[model samples]
Target: MHDPSLIKVGSCYYGFSTGFEGGPGNGSITIRKTCDTTITTGWTYVGTIWNSVPAWITTRLGSTPPNIWAPDINYFNGQYYLYYGASIWGTNTATMGLATATNIEGPWTDQGEVTNVNYPIDPNVVWGPNNIPYITWGSWTGNGINMHVLDAATGKLSTTDNNLWHIGNGLENSTITSNNGYYYLLGSRGNCCSGVNSTYYTVVGRSTSITGPYLDENGVDLNSGGGTTILTGAGPEVAGGGADIFDDGSVKRLAYHYYDANNAGSETLNVRTLFFGNSARTGAADWINVSAPIYTPITGGTVTVSSSIENFGWLKSTVNDGQESSVSGAMGWSSSNSLTTNHTEWVQLDMGTNKSFSQVKLFPRTDGANKGYGFPIDFTIQLSTDGTNWTTVTTKTATPLPSGAQVYNFSATTARYVKINGTNLRTNPNDQNAYRMQFAEIETSGMNSGNLAVLKPVTASSSYEGSDWFTHRVNDGQKNAVYGSKGWSSNSSLTTNHTESIAIDTGAVQSISKVDLYPRNDSATQLGYGFPIDFTIKVSSDNVNWTTVVTRSAYALPGNSVQSFSFTSQSARYVKITGTNLRSNPNDNNAYRMQLAEIEIY
Candidate 1:
């Protein structure tokens, strides 16, 4: 929910049914504050009628459905459409249903059953190209898991209901997302919300199509029970499987719930924040609870340091040299006295030649005095290659603050990024004050060893609204776009008719290596085309002269998918994407809306 008057007006949410009876009394769908942890004292219930009565429940039916499992909510048509599952425990006779309401607090109307399969449960709905509706669900029976197209006008299944993929043996609760051409599925592998004994966790699979043959990170089939465990139970809090996967524009995350044995039936929410886990944010299988949500402080100017602390109730030792938001990329560090509170002051670190850093140091800030080791405080310093899956480094109490200038010798830590975390607050133990974090000069590490940085256009191709396709340059191989300081003058007239090309001023680049293209189908007046878009990749050292690098026929299918072409080339000044053709039009048209990802010149 958004508005021009408010940054974010409100949001709607749904969760597992509470199994209450009489009316929708036992079931629940909630909408509350996005950043607020406190649940509203009162809730607007949507009633407890199941989408379909299981054979077992029908046999024992007193009047209503037995239990409601997964509840998914999506906004459409000025109202909220909720897709959920209903079934009797231990029976595969599960069914899916839809309900609509004008507001989160509503008089929800049941739209009838969309599926009558014996194993159709845990339904998740998504909109594909042209606003076409689609639903993905996991089951314990039949094909195991599948995806189906839903009618846009009526929330009913279309003829496109194919068993898209399958998950073998002991798996349920699957979700999917299409980004940069890859459709990722995050599925639960064990039991979830089962008090103290559910052994549930999460696994992930990816494919280029809505329906698959989905494969794990290792390229194993998900239908054959193959997947890379994205998350699992590591502590007493995580017991079973309950997963909800989503992307927040920049990064993808898996949100799930687990039961804590120590707390007795206390199910807590956990999120696995990621950025292409294997390629960048690796080893993210470690489960982190949502009990204490922490967000890093951001600033417009320079600061010595900015940090956030996640409370786990007990003290933890630092594992790695900490990471800070200011240490890396465009939002880099700088110092300013525009602080309104003494408890928290803005600190900045110089990005230097690059827009970010590799690491830094943090200490206690007692009236701007460094308390590196004066206090016996437990600290947790973490680092992320992509600022998501943070890995702890070390947890040692410093000897003390050096007598001279509140500085400590952390040696040459070789960190392009750094973060400082602390405990032992005088006011509230649960909440750590951002101001107490003492800091000093950061040892900015050298640049990355990768190829020269590539610039990716932020705006989409279809929305080529003048400012689209602009180049935001970077000194290192970092992915961020800063304004004014370091950017190339973007070419706005790059959009072509069948054979379009954009030439970069190679005076800035030392060499050229790779190119990535993003294409969004534009079916404005008609139904648009389907997969298999043929095109050629050409390069030129000079705008007038060009050479074909790689020529191959390709396709841009019906759903969300991205295709890329890479080849080695001489230091070229111009890069062009000459499309000979695209998917055949379903409604009849030659119009193509293509999106570009990045072009790398090393």
Candidate 2:
């Protein structure tokens, strides 16, 4: 089997493959279905789409036997078009044909040949930015990969052919996808079908326009023999090729086949996460292959830490800005800053609101040739919601340290402010007896104090109260019960197995500093009532791509006070609070419910 084309219709995913009848060697097109949206499990064979080659294909092949090589499936205007290749092994007489079906499980209507060119093995149709349908196909022996506009209503080429791209090494099985603002061309390189000896791998090139001049990350033009490698055989997987990409709601996923060495180099379907990020070297957006399937939702664009350091107030001892030995850089308290001092000094980052965190990282000064200069020899990390009372997070005593950043990880804790107290100083290596304490940067990771949900529009998976206890009540800014009730409550009474959620949309993407949740405190009996025992705070920019900012299991809320959670800043337009295991309200003995008085977002 080779060249699997995947498409999603309704609630199920369908895959079409080129294969033979007996033990997968017949020249027929087979289809399979899976209810799993990710297509990772529970695949059910849906039988063959075509077993015998059509008379037109047989006439075109002439002396060669009728056999399908590559089959690609795409959906357009409520019709599924299965484009397939008809040719013999290692021949240039290949022709592409189309078959249409209204439903995935189909009685396909043969649409005959669509392309007039020879060796049009891999036929993939993609909708361009202008919503125009374009089909691309070619083989190594042909004129590289060729593209032409398609009339989707008639299932035929509507424009003159254009040479889209090519690589010096023989490559074929082309598939194109438009993402962000660029069109990506994925193709197979090297030889295939040799089992463990197969050198087949995947390479990609991109262009702003779908017609011509595709380039790789290094600015090497695909038309001039340039491509960036994406996937290759490794370890048990002998060869990876025949790649295709599709949007799986949140992120793009690549579906291909790999020869498994351990399984006698049998070709098996493989799917993995595909990430697109800016290439630091090329300054262009490039595709990334993550080895495993990622369940996390990705916001459409890059999210860096907000540059507004002043938003989170700062405090420090010996705050001098002019001298290079000032605490200004250290007190700036951003990931990028270098602070130096010849005396013991302390710096604190005030988050402005209560938040939770679990880790702190300290970077020693390394701005110039001086590495590890003025590094702290001993220090104490403390957390506090109120400045007066502090809880010692960790203490270091005469610890030998290395240059660069060092991270201290601990159990999740809550704080409104974090302080790094320099109890002892290390002598500057270049200048002995010159006691100093300096750091390049300091960062706190995990949840911290800030309400990121304040004033945002609220939504829920299911609402218990249509009017009074609606989802919007959580963000209504009323902490105390105004008229006997304080917030939103779920309708699932005593239903401990149900999962409920409330979400907020901040309109545009904003840097999320922290989230604060206030439990229902209106009535004396409702104190500490209906708080989620297991909960997750998720953030998303497009509502569909959600990333879990924090997940707490078997958590208990004390009283009706506000609970703060902090995370390394994430940019999100939507924030959701999901609860699975809810606490039983004392007033309602039969039902486990979720209730929140207020939610704040910062």
Candidate 3:
């Protein structure tokens, strides 16, 4: 299945996908359904839109194309619309066609050949400023993504304004969605159909207006081949692309396909919850994975780096996310700061339970200026069951200055904790000439991956009801921005007294060593920890008797730093932080409040 789109009916989810194989569905659209609430599983094929290529398309092109690819599904006023593309391979252009039905399981009326353009392959329907239906199609050409204002009544090209609006370039399967005050154009780059060697990945660019120049996280224009990548190949999945955006009310999701390395390199479907990272002035923040994160999941997992530059959505967990940009990726774990680590910085992943893995792969940021810019000068990978004890699995003492994924293969080892300790750091002239340790992603193979704290019970002393500040988000695996993310924060009323607390019951407490705390990465509250001045971290075995692990006062402002509180190992089911003297809210003119982007206890 390639280029899949979804819509939920009363109680069922219907998936419309591009099908080019098998008997009845070749060269037309395929239909599938999953009754399960989780949209990823239990999908059974229904049928195709037609037994063969629609007669209108074959006659219009005067020949049969190989297949109908990239079918985008949409439900329009009093009807359902299916927009797709058909092309003979190697031609610069393909014909984009539309079909409509009252019910999704269609005897779809072929609305033939909508946009007249140089090359139109993937047609996606996005409503514009006035809720006006606009056809965003074309790609597989140098012309980039072009837009056609659709006639609202017919759901086809508008007669009045058929002028093509050239949007961003260097992407395909072009999809656009809006949030806050910005519009994002997400598309696919690289090849997709190849089996194991497929290099397909997703990239994104955003604009303030619906149509115009779009830029990536680092403000690179998309027309010049610039867009931030949100997901890529890792673990059992490879060659991820054919992207679409699904807005499920409170959250936006990225639905794409990847070649399954564990499943004979088959093209498979995957949907992960998309998250907004640190807010930029253009409202174009990098995307972070909240649920169904990109890499091999470690059950009850948490990642803490030795030190990091916490701005621009670069967090420790970003390494584990596995979403690296196709071009010069910017948002990754970078330790280019004044933190005192004795010139050694480390990134550690705590698998909730002991797991087995044979290989670890670390990727350096594609900073474009320097090939091995953020690649560690020298590093050693270690594993440990008890967090305190460690055994070196592999070490690269040599510089190994390469710009791609550095795979370190070792014998299968079992451990709850794994880390890459960078002994010597690379010089990052981009970052004030600081000694830097950076990685775009960290991946482990042959290990059981799952989120243990997802949907776990959470309790907070005070929480803002709306504005994306629900308390349960601390351990939900999604890292969102302070403004856009549903991170936990106190209501504005609690500005003076600092009695706020947040605790996560990690089901059962195992060997706990450290806690990772992320302050909201909103551009407004750029540095300060929203108002967590003085706090005591305590653990409880039965939720009644508590043991205070560490108590600190006069904690200085983190200034976009991920605060890691390491303490003596505690055996407890619950971990809580109670603030005594909460920090002052910078935006509120130094009024005190308690806020946190996320909390991970391990």
Which structure among the candidates has the greatest lDDT? Answer: 3
Which 10 residues in a row give candidate 3 its minimum summed lDDT?
A: 279-288
Displacement of the residue 347 alpha carbon in candidate 2, Å: 52
lDDT of every predicted structure (CA atoms): 0.44, 0.67, 0.72
Poorest lDDT segment (10 consecutive residues) of candidate 2: 294-303
CA deviation > 4 Å runs, candidate 2:
21-26, 64-66, 159-169, 280-291, 294-602
**How would you order the candidates by TM-score, starting with the best?**
3, 2, 1
Badly placed stretches (over 4 Å) of model 1 are 1-24, 28-63, 141-143, 160-169, 247-252, 277-602
Q: lDDT per residue, candidate 1, 1-602, as tens digits?
A: 00000011244233333343332444333332232211111123433433333343344333346345577766677776777776656555666777787755456777767776647777777666667888877665545677778876777788654544443345677776665667667667765545677766767677766667677755678877787675656556565355665543333445566675655667655444443311322312211212111111111222234442323211111211232212222222222222233333223332321222222333332223222322224455544333335445545454344332222222212222344444432221223322234332233322232332232222112223333223332111222222222222222222333433444443222235555443323333322232226666666655678778768675535342334455653556556655455443334344343333333433
Between candidates 1 and 2, name the one with more favorable TM-score: 2
lDDT of 1: 0.44
lDDT of 2 by residue, 320-405 (tens): 22122223334422221223433445666676655556667776655455566555678888888777799888898876856557
TM-score of 2: 0.50
After TM-score superposition, the amount by which residue 160's alpha carbon in candidate 2 deviates from its true location, in angstroms, is 7.2
